[model samples]
Target: MELTVTPAALDCFRQEWAFGDGEHIRVFVRYITEGDPPFAFGITRDTPSDAALTTVAGSLTFFMERKDVWFLQGNRLTIDCLGEDIVFQLL
Candidate 1:
């Protein structure tokens, strides 16, 4: 598994969220019964406890927890900005 954060996204995080270097960002799965995909991904500034995968993009660290591996396995995850919002793409 790999994680990529675009420069635009990094800039958004820095300016909007005040995230600094060495900060830990978590990507996790969220179940939504009303959603088209039935599930969605969410991001947050969090500390690693039982991270199954980790990657560095720019000055920030992005990680997925052990329980979230099922959603991330065998995929390349990219964090990009669409307007002022953060978007997650799995490829």
Candidate 2:
């Protein structure tokens, strides 16, 4: 699986999530629908497992469950922090 995140998105994530050493971003598929985009994504703090796929972009470490790879492959994600709301976009 491959993914890309924008600088603006990275900054937004940095401002929102504080990471301890060995901790990283975990992307999970929350829900899937018949509607547009078809899936809902969420972020949580976690450490990678042996089966997890990991990637580093800038100062961010991202981990995705191996089972999720087929779903997230080739995805581009954008994040924006608006006051207390964090917006996530998949392109």
TM-score for each model: 0.89, 0.65
lDDT digits (tens) for residues 1-91 of candidate 2: 4555556656666665654444578877776778987877778887677445666767678777876666656766555556645566666
The residue-level lDDT of candidate 2 at 16 comes to 53
Identify the runs in model 2 with alpha carbons over 4 angstroms from their true place.
20-22, 32-38, 73-91
lDDT of each: 0.88, 0.66
Count of clashes in candidate 1: 0
| Full-model lDDT, candidate 2 | 0.66
Point to the candidate with the largest TM-score.
Answer: 1
Top candidate when judged by lDDT against the true structure: 1
C-alpha displacement of 73 in model 1, angstroms? 3.8
Worst 10 residues of 2 by lDDT: 14-23
Model 2 clash tally?
A: 0
> Which residue pairs collide, candidate 1?
none
Across 51-87, the per-residue lDDT of candidate 1 in tens digits comes to: 9888887889989999997886689889898888999
How far residue 82's Cα lies from its native spot in candidate 1, in Å, is: 1.1
